[model samples]
Target: MTKVAVLGAGSWGTALAAVLASNGHDCTLWSRRTEQAEEIAEKHTNEQYLPGAVLPDTLKADHNLARAVSGASIIVMAVPTKGIRKVCRDLNSVLEGPVLFAHVSKGIEPDTHKRISEVMEEELDREICQGIVVLSGPSHAEEVIRNQPTTVTVAAKNTEHARRVQDLFMNQSFRVYTNDDVVGVEIGGALKNIIALAAGVTDGLGYGDNAKAALITRGLAEITRLGVAMGANPLTFSGLSGLGDLIVTCTSVHSRNWRAGNMLGKGKSLDEVLDSMGMVVEGVRTTKAAHQLSKECGVPMPITEALYAVLFEGQKPIDRVELLMGRMKKNETEDLAGWS
Candidate 1:
């Protein structure tokens, strides 16, 4: 069994640790809080993040950074995008040798607009990191922990490292696929949350499936436009990370982004929704980053702009929707001819 350290105790991290432990890997989950670590070890349940899920008994938890990564040859970074740099720096200080790093979090760095892998490369010592891989798709932690059938993709510039991560997590209930398009995968994963939030707003506004469907479809168009400008393959947006993830995040109750948007659409202030959820709604932050990125990339991301206005500029969600619907008309496939 391979030794793996999952460097976050949040739902996704805990669920991934459970997957590793179930596959007979010696997996340790690390949390910044000693109490959280102890709770996972003793209770086999992270009540705060993952309420009813029971983790594998063989899985270990550690509060100490050094202790958690001591013997691990593989590190699964599950920290939020906001915390990635600090965690990578901490890991770099304690790492003894080169190791394969796999990150599952999705979101662009607000100021730098760097993808998670780029941030990792900046913070982690080259001598200590063998390669950086991103693990992402439509899988949710709640369903994954239940051993429900799930499929996800791992991507890296090095195909070998991506396949290595695939082997580490694949099982009867969990399936893994490998892709070489790291930019596409990361972009698709990060931007879907923004569309999901817009979808939630549609639902909250009492708009029917027509509006939701349009948001998701047009949202993919916007995401693909930006991703292509940033050097990603257009076809990747049609795969699991793009269309699949967008659908799930936009529809599911388990999505924090969707829930937060729903609250906002129903008239709760941004601060109120955030306070009530008690968890990070990545879309909130990503919307700002995406809005800035669209401008920098010379891409038109109307939905992202609208969401940014609603979330940050105090424009009403309904007014933003009106703004979107009132945009200048063009052929649906106007800019997509070159993508094929």
Candidate 2:
């Protein structure tokens, strides 16, 4: 059995660890919280995150970072984007032997504007890191924990590593696909959360499906623009991590980003909304990174700009909507012009 160490123990981390364990991998989930580790190890339940779902019997949990990664073949970094650097630094100090790295967290670092994989590359010791793979798509933790049918893409520069990850997570209930475009996959997955939050704002403002449909479409174009400018394949934006992820996160009730946006639309302050949603809304931080990235790339991401204004500039959601609507009109295909 492949020895896998999944670090995080949040909903997504716990769910993924359960999948690995169910697939017969020797998996250990590491939580920073001692009590959380105790509960998962002893009770086999992560009630706060997974609610009614029970984890696999074979799955294990530990609060000790060294204990979790000890003798592991693969280390899955599932911590939040904000926590990635610290986790990687910790991993570098404790790591021994070569281990394949796969990251499931989606976000660009705000100041460095690095994707999760990029952050890993910068922090991880090159001698020991076998390769970096990214797992991303429309699959949600709530549904996946229940053994529901789910599909996702694993991307890496090394095709072999991507396929290996594909084998690691693929099963009847969990389907996996492989892609070589790491840049495309990471960009699509991270940027979609920004669009989903905007979608949530539309829903909260009592706008109908028409507005959401338009927002999602325009948001994809904006994401594509930024992604391509930043060295991503244009076609990747149309794949699972791109269009597929956008559809799920924007429409599903399980999306924390959307829910946070909904609260913002209902006139709650950003601070209030974040306080209510116990989980981290990745889109908030992603929006900041995207806003800065767009400026750096000289890409016109109006949707991202509007969301940024509402999120950080103290502009009202409704006002931003009007600003978006009143902007200069252009051919829809204009943005896709240079894409070959």
Candidate 3:
């Protein structure tokens, strides 16, 4: 049994801590809210996020970062992408020993457009880090918490690290695949939220399957383009991290990004959506970042660009869809891989 510390106590974090503890690993879930931590420790439940699911009695919460990670061999980061840097900034100073880090959050940073792993690298630096791994795929925390069968990927620069993560989390109802495509995994995991929002917009606009399919297809195109330009294995885009993740995020009702986008498509303003959700809709922030990155890299991400306009520029969602539908046609695979 591995000793695992999950750094976030949100739905995903608690769900994964349950995964570890249920598998007989020593799991400590940490949360910023002391009362919430106390509640989880006492009740073995997180009513705020994972309702109707009883956490393993052994799964506990610790407010102390050092205590949370003391002898743990694996540290899972399930915090939102925006806070990853800060989490690492605090974590680097007091981490007792080197441990494998598996970041499960999705979303690129604004302005920098750095992936989660890259941000972790910047915070901890390579010399201080033991290993970096990413856990991602179509798996949703709601389903995973219910012990549903779900598939995910473990990605790292070293295949060994990937394998280690896979071994750590694999179980009867949960399947973990290992891959070395860190860039593709990170980028695919991050960018799909954007397309998921777009998919939601399609649904909200009352557009049918054809529109959603086209959005998914083109979104994958631009995502792969940026991933290839950034040194990811092109094939990984077709795997669990890329295509698999995109499909799940775009289609799942549990997806916050898609839901937020659907709200926007249904006539709510961005502020209204944010006020109502009160959670990190990673895709909205990520859409802005992707728009900036595509411009910097000269990658044509028309869908992302259009979404950005709607979110930030106050463009009408319907008009954006109209424009996307009227765009000029091109070959399915033409210059899409960034081979030039």
Candidate 4:
């Protein structure tokens, strides 16, 4: 069994720690709050983030980033995207061993539009860093905590790295597939949250299944457009990280993005929605970044654009929906038609 370090104590991170420990790996869960770490270590519970899930006894916890991560064969990054750079920079100071990375984050850097792997490479800056891997799919912290069957894909620049992670996490309830399309995998994971929020908006407006079906179908088109524009394999968007993730997030009640969007669609302000959700609604920030990327990369994402208008420009949500519904039908162009 390999030793693994989990660098967050949030719901998703805690669930990941439980899985790693159940898989017979020695796992250390690290948190900035020592008390929270202490609670998980001693009581086997993280009452705030993951209610109703009993953590494994094998899951060790610590506050010191160095102590938790030291000498681990794999470092599982379960933190949000915004925290990755700071955590990596800090972890680099005390780590002496070569550690392979497996991150489950999903968001693009707003300023640079960098993928999570790019952010890792930028912060770590070591040739001997072992390898970098990204795992993403429809898995939610809630269901996975119940040991429900969930499937995910691991993508790395190197196929060897993907295979190694597959051995590390794949099991009876949690299955992992390997892929080499790093760009597509990362892009799909980040982009799907936006579509999920859009799905919630439609639901909030009381639109029927037809609207949601259209949004999911056409949203895949937009995600594919952006992924291809940014050098991802066109086919990857059709895979699990792309279409599979989109399906889960857009429909499932467990999706935080969908929850946040439900509030927004019901005419809640951004701050209000965020306050209600109590979790970092990644899609809110990603919508801003994606709107910026559409302009930079010359990609036309009408769905994203309308969502942005509702989110940032104070456009009424129902009005935006009506506008989208009234858009003229034409031959669906293949290459993000209006982007050019």
Model 1 steric clash pairs: none
Looking at model 1, which ten-residue stretch has the lowest summed lDDT?
Answer: 331-340
lDDT of each: 0.93, 0.94, 0.89, 0.90
Q: Which model, 2 or 4, shows the larger TM-score? A: 2
How many clashes does each candidate structure show, in the order listed? 0, 0, 0, 0
Across residues 1-340, which tens digit of lDDT does each residue of candidate 1 receive?
Answer: 9999999898899999999999999999999999999999999999999898889999999999999999899999999999999998888789999999999999999989999999999999999999999999998899999999998989999989998999999999999989999999999999999999999898999999999989999999999999999999999999999998999899999999999889999999999999999888988889899999999989999999999999999999999998888989899988697566
Candidate 2 is scored at a TM of 0.99
Better of 3 and 4 by lDDT: 4
Q: Which portions of model 3 miss their true places by more than 4 Å?
A: 125-128, 335-340
Minimum summed lDDT over a 10-residue window in model 4 is located at 331-340
Q: Which structure among the candidates has the greatest lDDT?
A: 2
TM-scores of all predicted structures: 0.99, 0.99, 0.96, 0.96
Residue 297 in candidate 2 has what lDDT?
88
Off by over 4 Å in 4: 333-340
Candidate 2 lDDT, 65-159, residue by residue in tens: 99999999999999999999899889888988889999999999999999999999999899889999999999899999999999999999999
